[model samples]
Each structure stands twice: as C-alpha cells, then as structure tokens.
Target: MTQVNRPQPPVRIQSSRVAESIAADLRQRILRGTYPEGPLPKQDDLILEYGVSGPSLREALRILEAEGLITVRRGKVGGAYIHPPNWSSAAYALGLAMQGQSVRVHDLAMAIRELEPRCAESCAEREDRLETVVPALEKNIEASEDALGDGAHFTEVSRTFHDVFVDLAANQTLRLVVRSLVAVWTIQEQAWADAMEGEGRYPDIEQQKAVLKAHRAITRLVARGDRNKVGKIATEHLAATQPRVLQFCGDRTIDASSATAMRGFRGLK
Candidate 1:
C-alpha cells in the first residue's frame, strides 16, 4: 500500500473579506474626520488608494452605506458622502432592533419611564444649568404653551421639550441612549396624537396646559439644580402622559418602518 499526499492550492480571498477590510479602514477614517469637508475620495481614487478591484471597492462602499456611514450618490454628482454616526442614526438602529424583536409600545413606554428621569437628573446636576439647560427647556416650554388648544401641534411641541431636556444631560452616553428612546417614543406618541386629533379625542386644552405647567416646573427645578425634585417631577410627568399614548397603542409593536416614523427622523437633528 502506498500513501499519497496532495499539494494544497493557494486560498483565494473572498471579496466580502476584502470589502470588510476596506470598510474597516474607511469607517475609522470617517469617524476620525479624515474626509471632513466633502464626499470621500472618488471611487476611482479610492480604488487606486486601496489597490483593490472595482467590485471590492464598491462592496466596501456598500458596507459603509449599510452602516449609515456613507451616502453613495449616482451620475455626475455621484460620490460617497460621509455621514459620521450621530444620535439619530443610533436611534434608528435601536428602533430597528426593537422592531425586530416585536417590542411593543408599552414596553418602550415602560423603558422610557425608567431611563428619561435619569436624564433629567443629569441635566439638573450639570453646573451650567442656567446657561445651558434651563433656557432651552424654558424656550421649549413656551413653545408648548403657545401650542396649547391645538392638540396635535401641542403634542409635537411638548415632545420637543423632552428631546431638548434629554439632549441637555451632561453625560454623552446617557444623553444619546435616552434621546434614542425618546425619539422612538416621540414617533409613537405623535402618531397617537395625530390619530386622536383626527378622531376628535385628543387631550383637552386644560390637559395640554397641565403638560406645559409640568414642563415649566421641571425647567425651574433644573435651573435650581434640584436634581432629585426634577427627576421626580419628570417621572411623574411621564407617568401622567404615557398612558394616553399607550392606550391608543395598546399591544401594538414598535414600528420602525412606519412612514410617519421615517418622516420623524428628518426633524431629529
């Protein structure tokens, strides 16, 4: 009996692997602000720079595009425009994940109930509350007040107050996380408002005024750096408001693909 050994052939690199490598490099550059001023180097230029085949380069760009990092345009004006990651993108991603899990409106509302109060507390703990948080919140409160009597409009304005309040939190991580949840919740709640308004069942003017008053009181507490009081008030405010939206939502799952939800992102930044 004779034993034979076969020589191993050279392994070919997969286009996906090459694309991933290129995507990794470009992703870091995008995050690092390497191409801050304009679209990324042209495809030809990137191809030359990376010394890869056109398909590999294109695949790499696709990868970045899918990650919400680059926007690939077409025709003469076509180039891969850089979009460094931000809160809205994070929120969209989070929404997708929640949607995939069939996360319900009430689940999101409950999670918001737990997380958003912490954001308010963080805002109150900021040393420059007067210069930063208070004014923004007060401005939003004024807008909310002005929109009173218009149910849908008032809902929109009041939601902005929460968005602004969360954005003012000093912790970047907490700000982003809470803001993402709020963004999702805002879409859901605003949809509820629009529907209820259409049905002539949206909250009354007095209820809207109560919401504005709560916002104003939260702002004052944030101004005084009353962290505990502001957090408590925020918790109470959310408790009072979320149920209406939740009742409309019932057991409905979070909708990441709703046309209304997609439109909502345009106003996020």
Candidate 2:
C-alpha cells in the first residue's frame, strides 16, 4: 500500500486574547458586508487597521482561518481572503461562543427538541408547499444505516435531519435561531461522541429505522394536512432522542451562580 500521511492537527492560538479581539472585528466587518467574498487586506494593512503588532495580527489570522472566516495563502496571491459564512459554519461558531459562556451541551439538545417538533408541525400544515421533508427523511434513513457502528457519521446525519426540518418550517427568524443553537450543540455533541463512541450504548440500528419510519409517517400526515397527527408523531420522533441526551447530561451539573458570572462575559443579557 502507498504510504499515507497523517493529517496535521489544527494549530493552536498562543494568544487567545488577541485572537479573540481580531476575530470580533473581522466577524463584524463580514456581517456588515464590508468584507464580502473576496480578497482581504495585506497583513501589514490589517496590522495597521487593528492597531496590533505583526505577531498579534498573524495570530488573529490563524484563529480566523481555523474558524473558516478567512483564507491565508502564500506567494503572489498570498493574503487573507474573506469567506462567506454558511449556515453550518455559523452554527459551529455560535456553539463555540455559547459554550464559552457556559451553555451546556445537553441543555442545547433539550432546546432543539423543544423547537423542532413545532417546526415539523408547521411543515405538516404546509406539506404541499414544502418538498424538502420527504427527501430529508429518506436521507436520514440512509444516513442511519451504519450508525450503530459509526457514531460520527450518525451524529452528522442526525444534525442534518434536524436542520432540514428547521429549513422546511419556512420561517427565517426561527431558522436563524435554530442554526445558532445547533452550532453550540454541535461542539458539545462532538465532545460527547468522543467518550461515548463504540461503548455499545448507542441507540440500536433498528431504533434509528423506527425514527425514520416515524418521520415518514409524519410526512404522510403532513401531506394529508392532518396537523394533529403531524404534531403527535413529531413529538414521538423527538422524544426518541431526548431521553438519551438527558441521560448523557445527567451528571454534568451547572451552578446558577456560575452561569450568572459567565453571563457577564457574553454580549447580551
């Protein structure tokens, strides 16, 4: 067999304080559309703009590169380029931000379960207008085929299924909130998966099939405009995963005082 190189681990930021400030500035510019999807300023220019030294600027660039906000290259075309943040990227970033402010992983999961079924119920109401649900349901099934033996893949597909429902709901504000919540939860779930992978404690392969079956049943009810059954089945589908998430977070305690203290570190009250 041909030799394969090990993938390099992501570089760590030596100065989080500097990196975070730079990241905040860059994030604002991007959000404001000042830095559209195009080339970015030279390092020296950014150094002057942010009023930071070379090392601090480079460190910030490294952090943004890791966060998928900017791309750095070398030679004639070398410089950081603005990257348009997608829903997935936004979600992960939001997750990191929330976790930094002490939002627990399982608590995030509970929040999703609370919102998603209602979105599903909405999809059921306008099933004629929405076409994404059935295919998303199918994808959920195919994605779960080997979930018992592959936790990472399973988690990704599961995330997709939940995200699709959020999309199908057709509410821009709700979609934005869901993506923000998912982003924070994704990091926690990744951490959770690391410890739980292959412990033979995952939901069985058949259990996943049942969830998909429920999804399809809900789709059918939605197609028939049976909002009541849609609501009921959506509840059942989500309840399937809620208990496991609760169990995972059972031992992870959060003190309200600590939460309050952390809240002071966040942007909003």
Candidate 3:
C-alpha cells in the first residue's frame, strides 16, 4: 500500500552458508531453464554438480523451497522441482512488507484509488498505439457480464479485468507495484466473496448492470482519446465499489500466508 527473520551463525556450520550459496546458484539455473525436461536436475546429479554432500544439497533445496523458487519432495519418487517465478510470490512478499509496516486494506485501496487512475490515463495513451488493448478490456467486461450472478467465479475473472488493465497501461513500474497490490487483494477478495455469499453482499443484477455499464463506458471513453475521462470514470467507479465491499469486510487485515493456505497450493507439474 505504502513504502513497502534471522538465525544465529552457529559455530562453524559451514554447510548453512553452503546452502545459501547453493540455493542462489540453483535458483538461477531453474530460472534460466537449465533443467528443461524435468523440473529439477536429478538429486544425485545436483550433489555431483555442486560437489556437496547429500545433506548439504538437501539443505540448499530447503532454502529454495522457502523462497518459493523450488519444491522438494522426499521418497523414491520425490526430488527437488523448480517452481516458476510468478506474481503471487511477489505479491506475498509485498504483503509481508505491508504487514511489517502495519498497512491496512484501506491503505491499499486508497493506493489503488490514487495509482490506478494514473494507470487509466496511461492505458488511454497506450491503447492508441496498441490496437488490441481496448478489445482486451472489452473481453473482460463481457466475461464479467457472463459471470453476473456467480460470485465465486466472478471474483476471479474480475481480478483479471483489473490486472489486464494495469498491465496494458504500458508502465512497467505500475504493472509490478500496482499488480502486486492487486494480486494480494484478489486473494483477500476471494475469501471475502465467499463470506458474503449467503448474506447477499454481492451486487445484485441491477448493481452489476450499473458496473458493467460503467466499465463499457470507460472502455469507450479510453478508445476515444479521452484520457481525463478514463481517469475520472475509473476512479469514481473504484471509489463507489470499494466502500460497499469493505463494509462487509469489517476490520480484517489481509494475511497473505493465510490466504495462500486457504486457497491451497497448485504448483507446476
């Protein structure tokens, strides 16, 4: 939202230091696709490659696992496997930062309100150069329309709409920073949507229709070189929607670890 642990050095446990260095090297290898066929080079092969003992290599793999760059499995069928780098990991990291600084969901929403309109302005300018951009937003709105009454499914797709808009805005900094906020907020909103299910907290069709109309209007305005209109409309749309959703949330702070736990993990196979 805003400006976003250690162990003691045990006496002469050189393997711990070894593990960190090994994790760094293997992280690069996985990222660079050195192990393309399989998610990992063989455990025995890694031991040989790194010239380390089995325990040391295992320790390195554990470090990588905690960093979310790899998954380590035990048993005969198990081995360390590379996990792809992704926004969720960055989002989790951002959540951790926000947690340390005592950031609230309200702060995050405010940041989005401030920054996303800038993204809208940027999106308007970029749409002129990239003809496909507006169509992409249009597709998202169509999908949202189709999901009008399905709270769970709509929760996921609606995020894609916001994420795609931020992405197409043609600003790398906003894409990374804003979308990290987006990624975490979506995780929270998924849980929020479920909590709101029976209580009828989700927008009714009329409200949904109004939102869809606004998005469609925003899309049209952005297409017509109306950067100011894009920013004004987007900000107002978000401002209007935010309080309604937060009204249901109360004072719950977003905990990234819990969100990931609740959603469960789906690592690359």
Stretches off by above 4 angstroms in model 3 are 1-12, 32-34, 127-130, 151-155, 259-261, 264-269
Tell me each candidate's TM-score: 0.93, 0.62, 0.83
Q: By lDDT, rank the candidates, best first.
A: 1, 3, 2
Model 2 TM-score relative to the real fold: 0.62
Prediction-by-prediction clash tally: 0, 3, 0
Instruction: State the lDDT of candidate 3 residue by residue for 95-119, as single tens digits.
Output: 7777677677777788888987787
Least lDDT summed over 10 consecutive residues: which range in candidate 1?
7-16
Give a tens-digit lDDT track for model 2, residues 92-200.
4565566467766566667777777777777666645346666665666567565645665676556566666667776877777776665455444544555576575
* TM-score leader: 1
lDDT (tens digit, per residue) of candidate 1 on 1-269: 89888966543457788889999999998888888946998889889999999999998999999888989999989999988889999999999899999999999999999999999899888888888888898888878777879889888888888888788877889998999999999988889999999999998998888888888888889888898999899999999998998889959989878788899876787
Question: Please, what is the whole-model Cα lDDT of each candidate in the order they appear?
Answer: 0.88, 0.65, 0.75
User: Candidate 3, clashing residue pairs?
Assistant: none
* Winner by lDDT: 1
Model 2 lDDT, full chain set: 0.65
Candidate 1: segments with Cα more than 4 A from true spot: 1-13
